[model samples]
Target: MNKNPVDAALILVFLYPLLKGFLFKFSSKNMKSDIEEIGGYISFIIGVILGTYLTKKIFMIHQDGVYAKIYNNIPEQIISALESKPLLIYVLVMPIIIFLIYKVVQIIIDLINSITLYPLLDSIEDLLKGKSGFVKRIIGLLFQLPKGVCYVILLALVLNVLVIIGVNDTYNKKLNESKLYGNICKNIINPITNSKLAKKIPNVINDSFKIVIKNSEDQPGNESGKTIVYYNGITLSEGIKSNEEIDSFSRELVKNKKTSKEKAKIIYNWIGQNIEYDYDKVDKILDNDFTIKSGAINTFNTKKGICFDYSCLYSAMCKANNIKVRIVTGEGFNGSNWVSHAWNEVYISEENKWINVDTTFYKGGNYFDSSIFKLDHKDRKIAG
Candidate 1:
């Protein structure tokens, strides 16, 4: 009188016909065609089976005992299991499930066509031709596929809703399960760190740093020039340190090299080598500012640009290095109050100064003179 074996076997067989027929009927009505009806039915059955299996597997891994331990106890166990499995398993399984579901639907369509629809079509036509008694029977049978599919779908939906409502406790347990949570995290984190996407990080970081420095150099004039140009908008602080990009760059510089001064020197040289001053380009100003990353990338790719290009390149490079950097804009020499200019100020820890490093003039190897650093180059604005 063992009930377990009998119950399990009966459940499996009963489910096969009940699910298959229900899905077939539901699909027929909704799809209004035999092919779609068969496909829908098979798809529905496969989906339910796979979904049930997954839910069971998850439940087994987490839930313990009949009276189901408190919610906390179940999730704690499941989380512990996921950490031990390799990431590939998760990646491989998802596609397989999708394929299986598709195959199941295909098989079901073939079975329905061969066993039911072909034999029934002749009778259906005879009834339509006015063969009284046979006509009623054929006509009724003709609507069977569509009606069946609808019934199946409705039943399946109702059952699913019931399970969701009834198994609230189990669902809650699964949600809080550590293994489930861990799996979610692993799925998100592993791809980012180990995939091709991670390779782009270094380039992004490097470019950001280069642009910041380049933008700083594009600012016009020496300290005394009548056009006291600002980089982006802010007047260059006497040693240049004010924003996040420069500060972060300063830290990275110290970490990567012997001193902040050495890092600053490399950044300074990069700007000087990359940016060039263009007077004709300045006259046709359109936009007041440009982004460093896009500017540097474009300039490097095209080999031609204006001060805005330099400013954008320098700002982006500094950003890549996690430095606090900004593009400043203000008045320049010759009473041209609207003459656009760009520059940067980087923080140097050893000197405890935000030094102004003009890559444009610095590239020209002009001697550094404090006399050229004029205070009249007022800060008009700032952008990062």
Candidate 2:
């Protein structure tokens, strides 16, 4: 009844002779001697196999079960390293497998000898005694050393495998994010930072239209009736209510602002701090609706968008702050090449001029200069 399989197997080997004696005594006198002899050999062989296989399985289960607990409690950083090196896993685990197999085979052979009453061992009780026994002991010692090494290796391997899957997912995410940051720096700010004499070009127009423009930064102009809208049972007078989030954001920024200059700076800084340029959306401008209705809301919520989204959202915020801003689209340099782009023009009360504010450029860092704003921001069609 010993639950330990190794001990039970050893006991069964010794007790087999007594059990066989009782069985042979109760057998019929007419039974063939060959039939009894064949049965004994067959039973011994079967017992050796079953005991070896079950003991191996039980030992493996117990070993892995303990390792599973250790694997769970290990630090995530170590887990990540282990997963990246699969060879380390093999080195750590293979030894344990070898040792377990060796022990299982050894125990099974002992069981076979006890059950079969093999003549080789029973004929000389001390065949494995004296110097012969000493040699056997030396062999056992050599195997035990390797067995220990194998167990250590396999334990390490199991723990490493347990932690790798999660590590791989986290690594992929960071790698993708790094690529995005690198792309943004390469695309948005690299052009203006490297540009020279772009300011001296006479074609960089300050004003195109013949009409006189006025500084409406604090004008509170009602030229557009859509400035005031009611939401949640409250009347709000904000020009840039392009979407609920933008509207809410505008209100929070300029709630107690006294002047248009302060409000404009707040909106400019907010857009510069929040939105990221959508490099992918630049190619799909014709297909995607990059207007205030959908674009501004999406940009504000997602924190990423093309120049169109940046301009649209900025225009909306300007309107809510009672400062008229335009989403201007035209051809501009984006790094080493000129491409179609969108930016903003906000009317300043102090300067009495329309100043370009590219939130996408500003988000790159504090690297963008206001003096050279018109160098790359070409004026095209304007949208309120």
Candidate 3:
């Protein structure tokens, strides 16, 4: 991701209006001819810019270190093979490629509807009247040309000049420096800021903390297994306050017994059943705690978060149950510009492999059930 606020702000300034315009014109009944709908093409162009901005933001947030690692790891043979592949194969082989083409086609369609069809139709409506003064007719014909062309041209030139000035100015040099400094802060400060209670525990227990401290008791050679157990125990403790609470919840759900999957299912159902999607509420809650500890409760109570919140919470809950989990964030179906989405890869011990879990759609109470969690791991390249 570029991490340039000017670039992002410029993109948003252009896209928000364009996308909104496209949607409005496309659905409006007042648009009788295509030429008058030139406004719609303007909107589509904005959408493209907005989509680009979104893609960059997502990549920055989710795939922090993955890109550098991938670049370093890329083999000469692999690069050669990739480079040698025919361009035509992109249509058949890469889903992301195909999706990009579709988005381009959509833009083209909007352009045609706005510039060509709408203008011609509006002109036809004017021409249908047989009588007019010669000067009046000439002025009307000039008016038929697309509106705001001169203004747009001037705006573009001014923007280009400003960009050049900003790039050259010593004052702007500080902006890049500040940006780099911010990135460093994010890399170092973020982990400490976000670390949970479990992550703070020492290898050797001093009996200061009240929890079981499983890993510390287990001696040397068996340390790794004990660490996993310890982390898993911390996760459970954080998830539910007490074993009594867990037992009571389990008994309420069934007559006698409950497996890990059953317990997970219960949590999943509860989240979906309780939480409503409320963005403002979620943002307000998260503004207080940036840690992963703000999981299902954040989602359930606030009822809003982007896909990241949804998947992270799901993974956290699975982890709480001693289930090993990995969170995957990537572009979804259709080359949708890889906007941020998150889902979990759960390790089912009985199956001995990771399986995908999407809690967002699940939480939506099946409103988005169709094709919701349909992402394939093979389709996703790991982002940090």
Best model per lDDT: 2
Structural similarity to truth (TM-score) of each candidate: 0.28, 0.36, 0.34
Worst 10 residues of 3 by lDDT: 201-210
* Pairs clashing within candidate 3: 18-43, 34-117, 34-118, 35-117, 35-118, 35-119, 36-118, 278-303
Return the TM-score for candidate 3, rounded to 2 decimals. Answer: 0.34
- Which candidate order results from sorting by TM-score in descending order? 2, 3, 1
| Residue 28 local lDDT, model 1 | 27
Model 1, 190-279: lDDT tens digits are 222223221211111101111233333444654433344333332333113324544454355446666555665666565566545543
The candidate that wins on TM-score is 2
lDDT of 3 by residue, 282-337 (tens): 44433532233333445544654445455545655555566666656543311101
Please list the Cα RMSD from the true structure of every candidate, rounded to 1 decimal place.
24.4, 27.6, 16.2
Q: What does the lDDT read for residue 15 in candidate 2?
A: 48
Residues forming the 10-long window of minimal summed lDDT in candidate 1:
200-209
Per-residue lDDT value at 152 in model 2: 29
Which pairs of residues collide in model 2?
92-153, 92-154, 93-153, 93-154, 95-150, 96-150, 239-320, 240-320, 278-305
Cα lDDT of all candidates, in order?
A: 0.41, 0.46, 0.40
